[model samples]
Every structure is written in C-alpha cells, then in structure tokens.
Target: MPRETPRSSRVGSRIQRVLGQVISADIRDSRLGLSTVTDVEVTKDLSAARVYISALGDREAAGQAVEVLNERAPYLRHRVAQAMSLRHTPSLRFMPDYSQADSDRIRSLLNSGPAGEADNKE
Candidate 1:
C-alpha cells in the first residue's frame, strides 16, 4: 500500500502547481529557458518554500535559468499569493533540480556494464 503524504507535502504540491503556472504564463525573461517546476518543499510552519526547477538544456543553461528564476522570485511569489488561498504565502526560493541528470548518469552506467569487468577484459 502507498504511504500517506504529509500535510507539508500536500501544501508543497499546491505551491508547486501554482508556481509552475505562474512561471510559464506570467514570467517573461529570456534567460529563463523552458523550465519545469519539478518539486516544492515547504517548511513545517509554512514560512518558506524551496522550489526545484529543471530546464531543457545543458548544465550552464539550467544554471542561468535558475538564476533568472531566483532574481524574479519575489514577483513570482506575489503572483502565487494571488492565486493561492493560504493564510500567508510562503517565501519562494528557486533551486536547480539535478535529480534527473543524476538518474540519467546512473542509467547509462548500468547499461554500459560494470567498470571492473571492462577493465579486467583489457
């Protein structure tokens, strides 16, 4: 059976949804590439939120996109506040999500077989 999600996580999910929509529809910065809000983590007291984002490009481009998002976080937060019905809108913090990249690397290694075995055959 699937475990129940925590209250903070539920709130985080809502925040993620609002943030993704706001970023895509409202924010207009060329530096910000095609970004997707991968996840959100909210504090227990709901004081702050850490938003994970992934960009469709190389590492440098993704970093640039994150910088743009961080620079425009206040405006995005305001937009999110307008959309959400929370007692207080959590402070937004943008972060690069590298989980996808890490997973891809692991998958490639697995497909390539064990490094020790390859070295032994040589």
Candidate 2:
C-alpha cells in the first residue's frame, strides 16, 4: 500500500491552487501584473499559511502585488472556504517569493568569467 499524504501538505497544495485562481480570475489589480502563487506553507494546525507569490514584472510591482494580496486576504480566505469543504480555512499571508531573483543572481555569478579569481589569473 502507498503511504498517505500528510494533511498539511494537502492543505498547502489546495491553498496554492485556490489563491492562484482567485488572484488571476477575481482580483483586477494592475500591480499584480502576471502574478502567480508559487507555493504555500501551511501550519500543522492549519490555522495560517504563508503564500509565496511570483510575478513577471519589476520588483516594485511584485512587492505591491504582495501588499495588495495581503490586504485582501480575508476575502480570499472566504473564497477558499467556499471552494473547499474544510472546517477552517487557513489565514493567508502573501509574501513575495524570491526564488527567481535568487536564481538569477546565481546564474549571473556563474556566467561571470568562469568561477574564481584563480581562473582569471591563469
């Protein structure tokens, strides 16, 4: 028999999906330029969640998007509750996911003349 998925993991995935749909289809804020829910981390008690958001625009715009999302978290929570049959919807705290930025920084460093000063010396 296969192992069962953890409850927290299930809730996190569901929250990620619901928030993505709500933001894309329901919210109409321009600051949210091409934003998507990258991931979600839900507490074991399922009382709260940290929703990671990613966007395709300037950092300022993405930051504004996170602010907007956080401000509308209650409404989003209601929407999620309506969509799911959970007794308690996780409280959403929107945060800007720095995954892309970090990856880009790493890539730039990697592409910047080999790897170390030793290589440039040779």
Candidate 3:
C-alpha cells in the first residue's frame, strides 16, 4: 500500500503553489531572472518555509538572483500572504536548489560510459 502524506505536507504543498505563483508573477526583482521555484518545505507550525529555487543562467547570475531573492523575501512573504487564505503564512527563506546541478553531473558521469572502458578495450 502507498503511504499517505501527512496533513502538514498537504498544507505545505498548497503553500508552495501559492508562493510559486506569487513570486513568479508578483515579485519584481530584475537581479533575479528566469528563476524557478523547485520546492517548498513549510514547518509544522507554519512559522518558516524553505523555498528552493533554481535559476537558468551562469553561477554569477545565480548568486545575484539569490541575493535579490533574499533582499525581497519580506515582500514576497507579504505577497504570499495576500494570495493565500491562511491565518498564519510562514516566513520565506530563499535557498538555491542545487539538486538540478547534482543531477546534471550524475547524468554526465553516466553518459561518459563505464570507467576504464577504453582501457579495457585491448
């Protein structure tokens, strides 16, 4: 049988959806361009949220994007609260999601073929 997700998880999912939309459409930070909200984890008490974000650009751009997001976190939180119908919206904490980068590296390793394959091809 499949395991059921907890109520907190459900609430966190909804909060993530609202936050993603609000941050993408409402938040205006030129420094942060073409950012994607990968995931959001809200605390059980709805006090804080870890917002995972991925950017489509170079390292410098990603760094700047994170800085901008951090600077505007308060505004983003307010926007989320406005968009969501929650009694206590969690505080937003922006974090660069490096899972995509890690996945890409793993894919590259797999695509490079087996280790010492050429050496073994005597």
Candidate 4:
C-alpha cells in the first residue's frame, strides 16, 4: 500500500497559530483591521500555505487588506521561521474567508422554507 499524505488541518493549524501572533505584534500593516485567522491550507511538501482571514469590517476593505498581506509575505515568512523549528518554513499567501458568507446564504435559504412548502402555503 502507498503511504498516505497528512491532512492539511494538522500542518495548517500550526501555521495559523504562529501567524496570528506575528500579525498582531510583528507586522506593521495598518490597512489590516480587526481580522481573524480562520484557517490555513498547507501544501503536501509544505512549500506554501494559504492563510484564510475573516475581517470584521467593510467588505471593500478586504482587497486592501489582502494586498498588505501579500506585500508582507516575506517578512511574515521570516518571522515564522524564527518562531517555528520547522526544517523549512513555507511561503505565506493570504486569502479571504467566505465561510461566514456561505453560512448566511444557507440560513436565508432555510428561512425561505422548503421548495414546495412556500407555494402550498400561498
């Protein structure tokens, strides 16, 4: 049998934890505001990681926030390297988290009622 690869959750979680600290204290990007690290997805070789963020502010600000993160990727990676004892630190890539929006959409759909139920009630 072939050896199974490790799930992203395990590696991603660790990266997220360290990144949260670095962003709050080390990074000096004023454009990023009231954000939470929702999750991270690390590649199998651990060469790169996608950091998912959920911001508690205007939707329009997300673009600028992402730009700031991408620009600071190198600094963030360096910070991670110093903090973590990994053989190789993966490059960081920021991505917006849409899970919250998906949840809201599902809630709205459910509130609309079953497909035929609304018609029957009418």
Candidate 5:
C-alpha cells in the first residue's frame, strides 16, 4: 500500500481555499485590500494554522489588511471548520507574506544594474 498524505497537509489546503473564498466574498472591511492567500501551514496535531497572505498595496496597507484578518480570524476559522466538517478546528493565525515584495525588490535591483550604468543609459 502507498503511504497516505499527511492530515495536516490536507487540512491546511482546505483552510487555504476556504479562507480565500471567505475573505474575498464575505469580508467587508475596507482595510482589507486585494488580498491573496499565499500559503497555509498547519500543525501536526491540527491545533493551529499559520496563514500567509499577500495584498496588492503598499507596506502599510498590507499591514492593515493583515491586522484586520487577524482580528477576524475566529469567524473565518468557524466558517472553515463548518465548510470542511473537521473534528477539530485549527486556530488561525494571520501572517503577512513579504515574498512578493522581496521578489519585486530583487527584480528592480537587477534591472537597475550594479551602479549607475542603467541611469546613464536612460
């Protein structure tokens, strides 16, 4: 028999999907900008999950959106548990995903050249 996938992984995926839907459709907070569920990490015991989110905005706006999401985590968790029918609802922890920002910064640096060469050319 083949080894089965881990329960935590399955639950994490479900949570990510449900949370994304809920945030986009149900959340009415203005502070919550165009947010995307980047990733979710659930504990082995299925007791907690760290949800990474990215939003289309500046750093301050992203921070505000994350704060709003964290504030609404309990409601989101309940909705997710109901949707998945899980025995134990994992506590949701909202985290801002800065990978996109980092990548953008790296791309800008690469395109700008090592020093002033690109500026001089322009």
Candidate 6:
C-alpha cells in the first residue's frame, strides 16, 4: 500500500505548481529564458523550500538563471502565498537542477561504451 503523503509534501507540490505558473507567465526576465520549475522540496517544518529549476542553456547560463530566480524569490514566494492559503508561506530558494544534464551524460556514456564486453570471455 502506498504511504500517505505528509502535509509538507503536499504543500511542496502546491508550491511547485504555483511557481511553475508564476515563473512562466508572471516573471518575464530575459535572464530566465526557457527556465522551468522542476521540483520543490519543503523542509519538514515547512519554513523554507528549495525550488529546483532546469534552465535551457550551458552551466554558466543556468547559474545566471538561478541567480535571477533567487533574486526574485521574495516575489515568487508572495505569488505562491497568494495562490495558496497557507498561514505562513515558506521562503523560496532557487537552485539549479542538474539531474537532467547528469542523466543525459550517463546515457551518452552507456550508449558510446561497450556493454559488458568482459562478461563474454567466461
């Protein structure tokens, strides 16, 4: 049986949804071009949230995107608070989500390298 989702997790999901919309439509900064809100991880106490962002660019550009988001975190948090009725909105912290790039690299490596060549030697 699937475990019940905690309140913090539920809140985090809501935050992620709000952020996705807010970042896409509300904020129109050129530095954040093609950036997406990938995930939101809320602390157990729900005091703060780490928002993961996947940006369309190289590492430096991605880092700049994150910096731009972090700079506007207060506004983003307020946007989330407006969307949600939580008594206290968690502080938002923008972070670069590198999992996508890492997975792509791993996939390329696996595809380019031989698969278990030593295993066939018996």
Residues 4-111 of candidate 1 have per-residue lDDT tens digits of 249778988988998888888888888888889998888887788889988876666678888999999889889888888898888988889887777877888899
Off by over 4 Å in 1: 1-5, 113-122
- Model 4 C-alpha lDDT versus the unseen true structure: 0.78
Supply the global lDDT for candidate 1.
0.84
Q: Which run of 10 residues does model 4 get worst, by summed lDDT? A: 1-10
lDDT of 5 at 77: 89
Model 5: runs farther than 4 Å from truth? 1-5, 118-122
Which residue pairs show backbone clashes in model 4? none
Best by TM-score: 5
CA lDDT, every prediction? 0.84, 0.84, 0.76, 0.78, 0.86, 0.84
Q: How close is candidate 3 to the true structure, as a TM-score?
A: 0.77
Pick the winner on lDDT between candidates 1 and 3: 1
| Candidate 2 structure quality by residue, lDDT tens digits, 14-106 | 888888888889999877888889988888888888898878755776698899999999999999999999988888898898788678778
**Model 6, C-alpha of 82: deviation from truth (Å):** 0.6
Alpha-carbon lDDT of model 2:
0.84
> What would the TM-scores of all predictions be?
0.81, 0.83, 0.77, 0.74, 0.88, 0.83
Better of 2 and 3 by lDDT: 2
| Model 4: lDDT of residue 76 | 86
Clashing pairs in 3: none
User: Which lDDT value does model 6 have at 64?
Assistant: 81
Model 3, 18-83: lDDT tens digits are 767876887787878888788777776767887878877655566677788888888888877887
Worst 10 residues of 1 by lDDT: 1-10
Local accuracy of candidate 5 as per-residue lDDT tens digits, 1-122: 12224988888888899999999999998899888999898888788888998888667777888999999988998899889987889899998998887788889989867796757778
Look at candidate 1 and tell me the lDDT of residue 88: 89
**Poorest lDDT segment (10 consecutive residues) of candidate 5:** 1-10
lDDT of 4 by residue, 1-122 (tens): 12224755576787889889988887666688877788888887777888888766555556667778889889889988987778988889998876775677788899988899868877
